[model samples]
Target: MAAAVLAGAAGSAYVVTVVDRPKPVVVSHVAEVLDGETIEVRDGDRVTRFKLVNVDAPAASECLHQESAVKLAELLPEGTPITVVRDGPFVAVSTQDGTLVNAALIAAGLAVPSVNGTMFLDRAKEAHHSAAEQRKGLHSPDIPCTLPGQVRAITEAAAAVEAQPLKGTKTELTVAADTAKTAIGLVDQLAKPGGLTWDAVAPVDQTVLLAKVTKVVPTLYRKEAELRNVVKGLR
Candidate 1:
């Protein structure tokens, strides 16, 4: 399932398959970074490995090697539950606020952007930018703007009350139904053996009937529980 990446406060819409009924969830601790692409997290005895999707960083043997790892390490702390987009075997890592960190790294010339399973760009640019002024090379360049720290972490409280999916909404549904011309005959008549099918609206008034159906309803409901969750930062 795809997880929505929040690019900014506006957020981006992404569709993920719903495998089960949606439930509120949270986590507390993370284990360690196995590599630039993989991280191991511990939930008590249940250790889960998350493979970062959409991008890859340099192997330790590469030029930036230690520098890149150090940067990722600095951004993360021990036991920080990284909120990730869990898709099957891999967890796509977005930023603490859902910004695309790996892409940002590539954009800032810190790491090469891997595409189609191969590193498309060479270290020519990365080396030039990261070669800190050690003369002997002891400097690490300051990170650029728009890199997300903590990668991403959904706080114990709700990040924001997610708008609940639209369901059982009569007004909106009625408007939708009214706009479409479909025969809505009696259930019994439709089910009859030799079906006595007839137009339910024998004398349909296009305008009057449309107005009588309903008004526009919102996308979702805001319950008190959801409000509390928003304040608590748990959605």
Candidate 2:
């Protein structure tokens, strides 16, 4: 009975030592804004580049890249004091006012949540979902360069093509085929990797956009196919 009590006491002590220890953190000041999801912080004479965990912003040449970088600059301008907790290769940065910079980017819709095995991943995901729903920043439908706006454009184009009658005279059939071809080209452009119109759209919006395109594109294919066959017969 004494041995059992001693064993239990040892286990409790081990738990307290391991789980209750404070994590190491870096105290620093922002030296420069690298991009939306990266920053350089100076700790005395040491300067370190910190990439925010669990968020991915648009790359250079992508839609909203400038806007995202501007937002991060606004949040953490040069010389802003910050606290950083290292999580593997990335860090969770917080302003003195208690704002989590990583989650802030996601909430503002400038960045999407990415898995990095960080402790704050769930918070980042929640912020991302809210931003997408609110249509903030990159998710805004008002911006012509954004993914949502492009999807809307494609949807409208497809609708216009579908409205035209598939059965018509040779001239009308030829025009219909031409219109459908244009709409299909837009879809293909959006889906293609490394294309001019391609952007790293958020996964949530991507799922919704995929469903919409899947429903609309097949009808367009049928219309174009029928029109081409009729036009060929007329020729």
Candidate 3:
């Protein structure tokens, strides 16, 4: 973890926190395509599996899973060299043909956005929304997509936090922080095994973060109101 303090032109102090993350391990050459979002690759002499980050495709038994797999196969055929990068608990892929595989999959409507946080969250959301609007792939009129297990848990956690009392005091801030931390733990626990399937958890992580943003808004407003009252009294 890294921290820095900055002073603005107006003499306001801001504390910035940064987390140092290791570079993702890039694996070259695809050995196999397990499904829509999972792949096997050659990492030196050993073969390992890497999950695609920030996208969740249908499971084998679910509707459109085969279609999703077929689409992926078309995009990345056998022996097609590709690059895989593992970022923290998630993995991302880039095809030899210059395809940002995660974003591509979402755009094609082959998968929905995962609940976990991703660097490409905005792009993925736009793609998912477009696909949904057009009734593409798994988002077809007859075939609705189901929220992954982890996504469901995080959504519920966000709802629970939103339902809490907002007293707009230091106590409320403490409560909100604790609740948000608990939600993070719950999300971590919900992550599935296999690096590729891990992308399934990103969507809800993003959701929980947004919920926290909403929760903090009231506290900020309360503080601003108190400050205004003090200024008025002085005047």
Candidate 4:
């Protein structure tokens, strides 16, 4: 019975030792950048691909895709040493200077927060929120290719159209009717799914919509002026 107890105690000690062992530090150098959120790293003779946890960048066909990739390249230059930690299916990468690359991308607005099993996810989400609020990178209104920028342009055009003064003369009424008809058509187009009012309008389509609004606003103003003139004549 004493031998059995000793054997059990020894087995428990062995299990505790194994469980308490620290994980090895993984050190690798950047070999190639796949995109804003993925990179290939070289560790001696082995090269492995790693996706940045808690961040998702624009795809190749999306707006700001190239810019996002360029920013990532700047952050992690070729041969730059990086520390990597596995977080579920993804990995968290940090620079030699201790800058978290995943959070950096989000803070720059080049990437959005992604659902990941990592302790850094909340920090990354905070960075993303700040970037969006500041209108940095892909969220900037100065960038005509971005969705927010396009939406601003469309909203401005609509405001211009609505700013025209209403007139009450007969000739002006006729012109106003024509202008109103055109404006109504434009509004109908904008009311459709994926249109200017939608959250997913394409930049090209937004440009076309802006042009239509710009072209009609002048006519609307002219019609309103003519209608006022007719009213004056009658008075």
lDDT value, residue 219 of candidate 1? 9
Error of 1 at 13 (Å): 18
Instruction: Report backbone clashes per prediction.
Output: 10, 0, 12, 0
- By summed lDDT, which 10 consecutive residues of candidate 1 come out lowest? 148-157
- Which residue runs does candidate 4 get wrong by more than 4 Å? 1-24, 159-235
Tens digits of per-residue lDDT for model 1, 18-94: 23422212334557766655667776788887655444555654444455565555444567655454434444444
Best by TM-score: 2
What lDDT, from 0 to 1, does candidate 3 have?
A: 0.57
The best candidate in terms of lDDT:
2
Q: Please state the error at residue 33 of candidate 3 in Å.
A: 1.0
- As for candidate 2, its clashing pairs are none
Error of 2 at 84 (Å): 1.2
Question: Please, what are the lDDT tens digits per residue for candidate 3 over residues 102-174?
Answer: 7677777788787564555555676677665665565443433323333444455556556555444555545
TM-score of each: 0.38, 0.68, 0.49, 0.61
Q: 1-235 in candidate 2: lDDT tens per residue?
A: 1010001122101000112223536566799988888889899999988888887888897777888899999989998987776667987777765567777777887888778845667667777767767888777867776766766766776687678776678888788778778778867866764421233355565788767877788877888888898788885
lDDT (tens digit, per residue) of candidate 4 on 204-235: 75576556655555655555455555555664
Clashing residue pairs found in predicted model 1: 95-151, 96-151, 96-152, 134-137, 157-232, 157-233, 157-234, 158-232, 158-233, 158-234
Q: Say which prediction, candidate 1 or candidate 4, comes out ahead on lDDT.
A: 4
lDDT accuracy of residue 4 in candidate 4: 8
Off by over 4 Å in 1: 1-5, 9-26, 94-108, 115-235
